[model samples]
Target: MESWLYILCICLILGAAIGFMAGLLGIGGGLIAVPALLHILPQVGVSAEKIPHVAIATSLAAIILTSLSSARAHHKRANIPWPLFKSMLPGFVLGALCSGYISEMIAAKSLQQIFAVFVILMAAQMAFPFKAQSNRDMPSAAHLFIAATVIAVIAALMGIGGGVLLVPFLTWCGLQMRFAVGFSAATGLLIALFGSIGYTLAGWDAAGLPDWTLGYIYLPALVGIVSTSMLMAPIGAKAATTLPTAKLKKIFALFLTLVGLKLVFA
Candidate 1:
């Protein structure tokens, strides 16, 4: 009982930090959430071997709510390009579903190794922001479909919002940064919804999941992290007024690099 309470506290603190960073950096909360959960879940009695899978699954599930709220806000501002969003929707959903099935078949250690590599790559991207020189317009339907499918699959596997990649891609293609951010927010919701469902269905009959888990998603961890992060995001946004965006992003990049190292060595 004491240990559970302790775990809950840690999760809350972790969520708060993640939320603040998301708001400040405009990065997806999953950027921090996945790594934090990778550490926190095991302390709460999740098996060491299954920790990576559980962390990723739970992170994706939590993002469903976070993304919905975010996308709604962006939509209210008319930031989302409905046509572009629609073009990508079907492919994203299909890829997420396929990735969910694939995740279940993967070995635990292998998944963690993959996640570690992804984390380092994301950190590098964050530290050194992409400046795409291309000014091409949005691609045609067939091209968009294929592109979205690839992005969604990779995102589902990495347990991240497609925003990390989508935002830069859109900007390179001549979309304004603001619109790209908004579009990324909307697309993230679709990815999370389908990916979460995939994980749930894929692990439906799996053995050895802890109590309070729905398939691979751990309920207690999700509840704690999502609730706190959602509450803290606006706080972080408000606080960012006092700091430089570039500095904050650099700090976040350093943090990710450290987390990536930890995961790789552990």
Candidate 2:
């Protein structure tokens, strides 16, 4: 009981940080949550082989609330491109729903390595920001569907909201950055929702999951994380306007780089 309490405390703190950084840096909490959970789950009786699966599933579950909040904010601000979002919604749902089953077939170590590579790439993108040139027109509906499907699949696999991939893709297709961000946030909610469901279904009959689990989602950790993350996100957003965000992003990028390397070599 005491150990459980200690783990919950750590999760709360981790969630607070994830929320703040997400707001401040405009990054997904999963990047941090996945790695942290990889460490925390073992202490809660999660087997070594199942650690990555649980971590990714739990992170995706935790994202639902945060992404909803973000999407609502963007909608209120008229940031989201409703037509575009609507057009791609089906594809996003389909792809995210497929990712859970796909991941179940892959080895845990391979997933960790894939996540590590993703983290390293994200860190590099942060440290050296890339401005997408808006040179092309929006593609046809079929093309949009295909693109959205691909993005959703990758995002689900990585336990992320798909902003890193979506924003750039939108911008490259002549959408403004603000609209791209808003659209990405809106789509992230769908990814989280459907992805969580997919993961839950995929792990339902799996062996060796710890107690208090809804399939792969760890209830205690999810509760602890969502409790603080929701409250802290607004505060962090408020801070972003006043903070030296460029410098902070660089520092955070370095931190991500280290975390990625640790995962790769661990």
Off by over 4 Å in 1: 2-6
lDDT of 1 by residue, 12-90 (tens): 7887887888888878777777877777787667787678778888888888888998999999999988878677888
TM-score of each candidate? 0.93, 0.96
Candidate 1 clash pair list: none
Could you report the Cα RMSD, in angstroms, for every candidate shown?
1.7, 1.2
Q: How high a TM-score does candidate 1 get?
A: 0.93
Leading candidate by TM-score = 2
Top candidate on lDDT is 2
- Residue runs of model 2 more than 4 Å from their true location after superposition: 2-4
